[model samples]
Target: MSRLTRRRALRTLAVPALAAALALPLLAPPAQAQAGRNVRLLVGFPAGGGSDVIARLLAEKLKDELGGANVIVENKPGAGGQLAAQALKSAPADGSTFFVTHDHTVSILPLVVKTPGFDTAHDFVPVAGFATFANAWAVSGGTPAKSMAEYVAWVKNAGGGKGAVGIPAPASVPEFLVRLVAEKYKLDLVAAPYRGSAPMMADMLGNQIGAGLGSVPDFIDNHRHGKLRVVAVMGDKRQAQLPDVPTLAELGLPGFEDLPFYGVFAPAGTPRPVTDAFSAALAKVVALPDVKERLTAMGLSVGHVPGAQFGAKERAYSAAWAKVIKASGFVPQ
Candidate 1:
């Protein structure tokens, strides 16, 4: 055929090719399963703390699981995790930003703080939850105490019936635990509140504080190294990492096995599709061997609860802490 004829034929085919290309997207599934938008994982505590570490860990792998969208960790440390929790209330109700926080911000702080800045029931929606952590009542290595019984006796003998135990946050589960255990065992004890676990562990290592009630991550390594002795853990069972360690229930503190949960939540107005997508990705993220290993090593029990169950768990936990706070006469600050 002539050059002109061939050129006319090529133009005729190009029109149909473009039309087919445009129709492909209509036939394809909605891209809702993969949150292609950028994601921010907010942490309410300083970097290197347990909450921060877990946030970073899950965020690191979660982005890949959610289709390689950029996921970054933003630290908004203040008011014992209230700042970050409050930010979620105003955050865009999309998959773009979410908070990775545990019970302190979700369940406990709101009940304990006079003005916590946000309401859990209305401000946020749980997406997925897992990794319940326990607070260990640990004593310094210099003290001659290997068990809860011995630790109580040691505090009684050395400090003249007055002893202090460090807790990372003022209005937290660990702080209330100090009061409850002291009242239960009839020991003269005070709760020394710290800004975070690092400072509390520092004092514990230097023997400035005779004992501490902090999460497993704060004291696990030291306890393993003989620098500190964990008297009793408060998780569902003795940690596999420290098989010899006793759980609070096993050590005779009944009804304390179920501890706090680490969860991800979005603003209350976030769409169901977005929240569900994140939860599905997170379920896979937590099931990863490396992810589970790292979290378990840091003293978290790897598990997953869908949004509804997680929300129920949060409410139940708040109710339980409410009783403890009231019993302790802890006026909210």
Candidate 2:
């Protein structure tokens, strides 16, 4: 063959090859795009709070589990975790980010807020669960009430006015519980919502509020130290950490029995492989004996519900809370 003809044939083949190379970038897969990328773990509460602690704990180990990927925790900290959830919605779904939060942010918030920034069911993918947390109602150490029955009698008197109770956030499960308690026991109790459990707890310690409601983990240490008294916990049975504390059902309020959940989530459409990888790594971390001991020490249980089951769990939680919120006639603030 002539040299010029051969050269023309090679140039013709090169045209299609160059075109195909240009198209490759558009078809890039999530796995290659996410390889060795920095991961952002988010918490919707202050740095010292339990949510933040859990996120940081999982973040440190997850980094090693994910093959030494750079992982960092960012605290968004407002609106009862609404800000962090919305921020997660705005992130790229490439699998480098996740939010560690409780049922309030995922299942309860959307039911209370009329126009929440994102849909709980569609905006994020539930990746993994840490545990179910039982909310507890407690009184200040000096309040002269050590048991649920005594606490009810104390609230009934309450200086001849409605007793004030500190709740962690407005429109939260605890806030609704205040109403439920009011209706069931025929006691006048006012709900005072605060930024978070820590601040509300400060007032409880100062004796500014007779009683407070929050997650048992938030109250257990103080309760154990004699700074506060947990009267009743909101679950079917007493927690191992607070075995002496009566369950709500044990106190005759059968409706306030469901324990709230805690879990992590990635933005919607995040690659399944990426979420599954995180779930697998987390199972290992949660199974560690130290992890279980520490979690139980803080009033948490070691219940690891994986991605799909967790999503279903979150939905069922939402359905139940919707009825409670509606029945309470709470107007979101």
Candidate 3:
């Protein structure tokens, strides 16, 4: 008990306590405010596709919001989106890597493709919904069917077998819609799958496929060039760009009214704080006037739901499409 000895002991205890406090966060889950030094956004389609476009847009804003950290997009298109889903599964559960895609790859593909590498319910956590768009049912300009009714009748009377429908991203939302159309109208429509919308449009214009099903933007230019004819859209209401085109519900198919949406997700087990950070950043980006205007120009509607609600919406979409795909007798190829 000298004063110096007592002071030395106190200093020793104080140093250890300070070190422990600093190490606590390293052991605990990451905070929502901590953006990764680098981020990678995975797109389940090739470059130049709608999903890729959206991913890049968000990546740019995320980088700006996150102190200029590099945000990059990686496209892994194949297996009806199984490739990207699998890639996501292998990514660390940290917030750095995420997958951005539509309802098809997240919900529909699992139902069609047997044993896809990941499960939406168990393998991934919803981060945020970025935008929603409608699918357009269109045909090559040379086809005899010019309208929805005409297309239905043509498929019915073409020996119930000759004509084929091209679907971008088989086992996707558009493919399921094609199946529903065939069953609802009692037509024997054969389905042909393509890697992405661009390739399918090429085939449609070449008259290799009888008709095509994909996002409206995919064929918007083709329609403008007089190489494609939009028969109907799958939105609950008519699309602004194609106001004259009726929706499936308006055309007598009320059950096909769901608007397709695109969202971002991280692999399951990602920390909740990280998910919240991502969701919040996404909300900010979607709210930006320029971002909204740009996406709207591309035929996208800007909207976002919270992470938990987005997850529920994803599950609901999965169930709804499952019924449709089953009713259409679609088996995984």
Top-scoring candidate (TM-score): 2
Candidate 3 global TM-score: 0.85
Q: Rank the candidates by TM-score, best first.
A: 2, 1, 3
**RMSD (Å) of each candidate, 1 decimal:** 7.3, 4.7, 4.1
TM-score of candidate 1 against the unseen true structure: 0.86
Off by over 4 Å in 2: 1-36
Q: Which 10 residues in a row give candidate 3 its minimum summed lDDT?
A: 25-34
Better by TM-score, candidate 2 or 1: 2
Per-residue alpha-carbon lDDT of candidate 3 for residues 1-333, written as tens digits (9 for 90 to 100):
999999999999999999898755434433324445778899888888777878898888887665566789999988667899999888999778899988888888888888887888889999988788888899887678889888777766764645678887766777667767887787777778888776787788888787988898677767877888998998778988788889989977788777778898999898776787778778888999999988887778789889888888888888988887787787876
lDDT of 1 by residue, 102-193 (tens): 88888988888888889999999898897788878899877899988988887778877679999888878888778778877789888998
Candidate 3 Cα misplacement greater than 4 A, ranges: 1-36, 152-161, 184-186
lDDT of 1 at 304: 89
lDDT of 2 by residue, 129-160 (tens): 97888999999986898897788888767556
lDDT of each: 0.83, 0.83, 0.81
List candidate 1 stretches off by more than 4 Å: 1-36
